[model samples]
Target chain A: MPSTTSTRPGGRSARVRAAVHHAVEELLSENPAEAVTLPLIAARAGVHPTTVYRRWGSLAELLSEVATSRFSGDIVVPDSGSLREDLERWAIDVSTDLSDPDTVALMRATLGSAAEGGCACVGDRHAQLDAMLERERSRGGKAPGVQTAADALLSPLYYRALFTTEPMEPGWVRGLVRNLLR
Target chain B: MPSTTSTRPGGRSARVRAAVHHAVEELLSENPAEAVTLPLIAARAGVHPTTVYRRWGSLAELLSEVATSRFSGDIVVPDSGSLREDLERWAIDVSTDLSDPDTVALMRATLGSAAEGGCACVGDRHAQLDAMLERERSRGGKAPGVQTAADALLSPLYYRALFTTEPMEPGWVRGLVRNLLR
Candidate 1:
């Protein structure tokens, strides 16, 4: 409870940032229907409201940042020995993560305002897919481009989670993995 | 323009509805960056603000309805002799339509709120896909179900449009069609 700046670099600033993001994720996952406001998020985060506004500017950007950090930090890119197995496992993982209503709400929240360069999570996913594909190629495996992975592997899951009522049918993710390999 | 109840059935009421929808489409497509409001749309449509509010209730609902009509009425389900060709053509058409910044904005505007049964445009698309697939089956042409068409054919495009900055690459739509046919 009584920590100094020595243990935590950037002192309270970094801790506050982490706390805000964690609070957002918890609030979203607990009740996707809850109207998430800056004040509410600040209260839950135990940070001043002014700090959030000064830091993130708007709720959309805050949500985008939270979503981006989630993709980059929370989830791990699969690195199975085989390209097919790796992509299949990755797709299933993505589908499972997106199947949650909270994640879907978070995803939807990140979009729909101004399409200024799209979301940061996309670039994050691309880097992730690139990492997976790079591992495959290093192992003397054949794989399609990142765009193909975006098209074949990840797009269907995101599209369903954002647009349709049905997220994933049985064996849906595996079929996508099979397509790129073929 | 002069109209009568005998000539236009619903007369002024139908005309007002059409005008408001046309206004929304124009405002959304012509300048997607415009801050679309009931007053703004009403002024453009030459209708009373109260009328729009009374009829549609909210901008999201209005946008959703306009999007539904565009999918259901404007776009035709491609009908080539072959299922592969038909699906490919349809995919290309969708890619082209969504290639427009206005259409992308319109599509994005339809989402990002409460995921109440997703969007109505989805139902319209499913119906169109079903119609196309039914024709293929009748002609003894093999085709996947509506779900497959959604995942392989449409999902990638929508995913790119909403999530990624790069929408459709050259020959990308055709590649999606190829995956399903094989």
Candidate 2:
């Protein structure tokens, strides 16, 4: 069993956690992901090595936590009255997030590794979408088939981000939402 | 400059080519792609080290070529009576192909490295799709918007294959096509 650093009785616990996460993001942004290690992260964060090791157990787990926590903030489901408008806004926001080089590298790192925890962020986002669609269904609106709509609208931005250098242009996002609704 | 083995006029030349491609497929199927190398591939292929080196200067380039050639066989554009029908068939076939473990590994390999040639295969498939849509438009069918349709139908398969462990069930494929058309 690992020591419970998050629950430890120290005023510095929260600061240490924030510093570690920020260090991970900055390292990922400036250097290759493979070069990042717990010791390196600890050194960058000004935390002790034993504390980092005790908390995370492994680099993959640490990265997984970082990815999930960082991206959970980005998955806010828009409730703009219409599913179409909501999807349009969601896709554009996601595209903007993926456009950042650091975000792209983080996604690439998560995909390259066999970390199940890394995909937890995407799963959370999916759940948010499902809830939105459920709300629409309860409102006497026809079921928009949210999973299929997500596949159609969201997958392309990911495809382009991972497979090509194509920009996820605003026009493309709008057209994708329009076509899915049509 | 690397020697042109493909242009060499010998019975062994073709045999060597097939063996190398088969070896690459076997290695990818069994091992982590990062651990694969030209020397190991030559050993597995039973071709000379110089030959593998001569043809592909780096592991990334070799893997990219393997990915492109293997997937090219999977991109058959169906010409059914209607765009909807054609899309349905294509989606199902692509889904089936992506279901194969070997095909999945090959895609994972290509994506783990920076290989522009690896993406050429997908580009070719997109072109085939574009041509099919163009033909439909010429036949007095409303322009079934090639890029948007591609995002709707194709990107989902790739996304699910890479991002999730979910089985691309046949019922799911049918439902996706129906929803897109609706």
Instruction: Give the winner by DockQ.
Output: 1
Model 2: interface root-mean-square deviation in Å:
3.9
lDDT of candidate 2? 0.73
Which candidate number would show the highest TM-score if scored against the true structure? 1
Collision pairs in model 2: none
* Candidate 1 residue pairs in clash (backbone atoms < 3 Å): none
- Chain B only, TM-score of each candidate: 0.86, 0.86
Specify the highest-lDDT model's number: 1
Q: DockQ values for all predictions?
A: 0.45, 0.32
Worst 10 residues of 1 chain B by lDDT: B112-121
Q: lDDT (CA) for every model shown?
A: 0.75, 0.73
Candidate 1 per-residue C-alpha lDDT over A19-121 given as tens digits, one digit per residue, 9 for 90 to 100: 9998887777665322567899999999999999998997877888888877664567776687777777777877888788777767755665445557654
Q: What TM-score would candidate 2 get against the native?
A: 0.81
Could you tell me which 10 consecutive residues in candidate 2 chain B have the lowest summed lDDT? B112-121
lDDT of 2 by residue, A68-149 (tens): 8877866678999887777778888888987787887676555544423125336466766677778888888865676766
lDDT of 2 at A133: 76
After superposition on all CA atoms, how large is the RMSD of candidate 2?
4.0
